[model samples]
Target: MKLEDLRGRLMAVDKKFKEMYEGLERNKIKSIIYDKMGKPVSLKKLSGYEIENITEKRGIVGVDGSINSYGGIYPHYISLIQSMAKSTLPKEEDIILQDVYVPLFEDEDGQAEDELKRRARMSKLELQAASFAMESFSSKVIFMDGSLMHYGIDCPSEWKKFKEKAISTGKIIIGITEEVKTKDIAEILKTELNLNDSILYDREVLFGILNEGEMLEFRRDLKSKKSESGIKSCYVRLSEDPQVAGLDFIEEQYVEALKYADLIYTLTPEKGRGIPLWLDIVDKEVKVTDEMVKSLVESTISREIREMLLNPKRSKRG
Candidate 1:
């Protein structure tokens, strides 16, 4: 069958399964945690949790740390328990987040593409982390923070291997990118709006642990005048439909990497507010506390920025 035809059929199947699962009385969704090396780790089993560890490799970096230099290596962990349509007890199959860390390196010859390839390699480590988490508790789905493919760069073989391994195990792999025009937004504001590129340079700018209220603010900015244009791609490896048994969703594209994937899922929302809201699904039921989001946001941002600044170009002093 043609690719489009296959996808449509899969979507139909997925929708059916989702409807079926929605009606079942399931209890508690389990979330898996993975480190930068893809090894699974124990996380506090709280819905809205903020975990911080001071590793010998990465310091006790908060979401507010720098993104481009040396510091502690950190990754974001998010697990949300979605309420099925039918309310029996409470289903325990939850989604796990693999916020992989990419190390910073100097690229003088415009080898930013290489950085993306490196990021793909870094993701392999995250997959290992997922595997370890799965060994302990069964999770319904794994939600990755980025794409299966390397963005703006050719994909490496490891990316394909990691993605396919996740699919064969009957676990859904859902990838989400909230802002499609992230690079463009950074550039546009850098030029048109005269926003500082230093904003991107700040290693602490990207990470955040936002509550429902703060999430709402970010979502508002995402859809309003602060809205940026680009493709926030979503990809799934299970069935194209959300109802299917093995539905994996990837929001971004890969030239050859996706070819190895059995089912690819995508949904282009008119508004780019799904991520923070989706995160709120479990946050509301748990009555998430302020400290949860605060610590997470601060640590994630700080760690990411410091990583980006790993190998900066030195300025020549007179």
Candidate 2:
């Protein structure tokens, strides 16, 4: 198809998109959200949750994980998982951990085994780091990289351990997704708005939907549907950017979770992506760079091992 043809094909759905947006507006989607199970809240701290109290007494801890693989194919590749949990408090030190997994001995019969193994390993490592952070730091709040539901789904046992630890310790743990991937609100609104044929993710449905400094929450039924056991989620537009973010909370601690919204929003920049600036710092620190991985492999694994077990055929092509 020509460029004009491509443009025309894309434009074919414009009417539907526009009508959907109009329908949401006509129905007062924000109020509908209130009735459904969530309360939209402004980015203001509740009493005793002021900036000084947040930054000093109840410092926010950011936990994030990174994974990198060297080599090709299932059996030949080695995956490295690194997670970091760092407190926003200047006095507290960073908690960093690493795990490496190679599928040399593990039998990979299915195509998905490699992917599953890597993700599970990474999730487990992240949760482990988070649990460690809870014990090491006096800070009561932790902001994890992804949704709480993802941790449970990806690594249930580790999630259970981490959840129990946070609960017993009287600490708060929240998951922040830089890019919202949930579809619960979209599905519910699609039904409510009488758009049965529509298909939309939360990302598309919520684009520019939330007002600046506002968050979208929903009812208990939708919360249970969208989350795994013990987890709940909401969407927040913390910055001037139209893009929104997902914030997941522990079910019982959701009240406490909402109270921290102001603190998080305070850390987010108007000119930046919706994520808090501190979490972005943790992300950069936690990432396992290519140079680091290369140095690690070369220093630890000998030449024969590298040739036989580590290097993929693609490495030699050039």
Candidate 3:
């Protein structure tokens, strides 16, 4: 295509975007949400006195994980997966748990099942690390870096045990999602209004609909043929930025979600995106970088074995 044709296409795309942007009414969407769900939950700033009261018994902890593959394809791949749980208490130490997945060692069906296996393995490791954190630390609040419902889907057995531990120990566990991805609200709206407009996701709908420190009360149900999970989830604007974040809580402790939300909002930076600083620290500690993968594979595996079993032909070409 010539330059003029490309310029014409770009102009058409810009015009279509403006049309869509003009059609959005955030307040109206917010009203529709309240009709389907309940009223919004108001989140107030935590005063020094309030913080002291909440943390008097125990400090908060954050749990996060990393998953990566070092080799080329199929049975030749070696995945490094680990999860870390860190506490805010000065005396407490980080708990790190690791897992290694080699398709050669397992009875995996095919290449198509690789990602699902990786996710399930990562969830298992994360839940185990969380269990350790709850048992070992003096923390009343435990924050997981991603969706709570995800683990339930990936590793249901381990996920149940983790939730049981949380309930038995009287700990508040909340999942913090940097990116929200769910379409229940869209489905509701489409059915109620009887129209198909091709635009209704919780993330896009809640963009600027919520005020800073305010949470849109919601119930996100995870339904599958094998199992069903009913976790309470909400979109909270922790900072002044228009971008919203997702907070998921187990059904057992969702009644006290407000109390936990205050602590989370307090720890998040007022000027930045809405994620707790503790979770960021845990993520940094648990991340499996390329260099770390390289070092682990090179140090542990014999060169002859690596070349015969795990090494890719692309490495030699490069």
TM-score of 2: 0.86
Candidate 2 segments exceeding 4 Å error: 1-37, 45-49, 55-58, 221-223
lDDT of 2 by residue, 206-284 (tens): 7776788898776666655546576777889988898889888888788877778888888888888888888999999
| Residue-wise C-alpha lDDT for candidate 1, range 1-318, written one tens digit per residue | 359988999999999756533422212111110111012111121111211111112111000000121223222122111111111113433323333233233333344554454454444444544454334334434444443333223334554555555556644444444333234223333343344433431111112211111110111123312122212221111211121111113323222222222211112121334332332343343332345444554565665653454313342233
- List ranges where model 3 is wrong by over 4 Å: 1-23, 192-199, 219-228
| CA-lDDT, candidates in order | 0.30, 0.80, 0.82
lDDT score of residue 155 within candidate 3: 90
Candidate 3 colliding pairs, count: 0
Instruction: Name the regions of candidate 1 deviating beyond 4 angstroms.
Output: 1-68, 71-114, 151-155, 181-273, 276-318
TM-score of each: 0.30, 0.86, 0.88
Q: How close is each model in CA RMSD to the real structure?
A: 22.2, 3.4, 3.3
Cα displacement (Å) at residue 25, model 2: 6.6
Q: What is the lDDT, from 0 to 100, of the residue 254 in candidate 1?
A: 25
Best by lDDT: 3
Clashes of each: 73, 5, 0
Error of 2 at 50 (Å): 2.4
User: Which ranking of candidates, highest TM-score first?
Assistant: 3, 2, 1
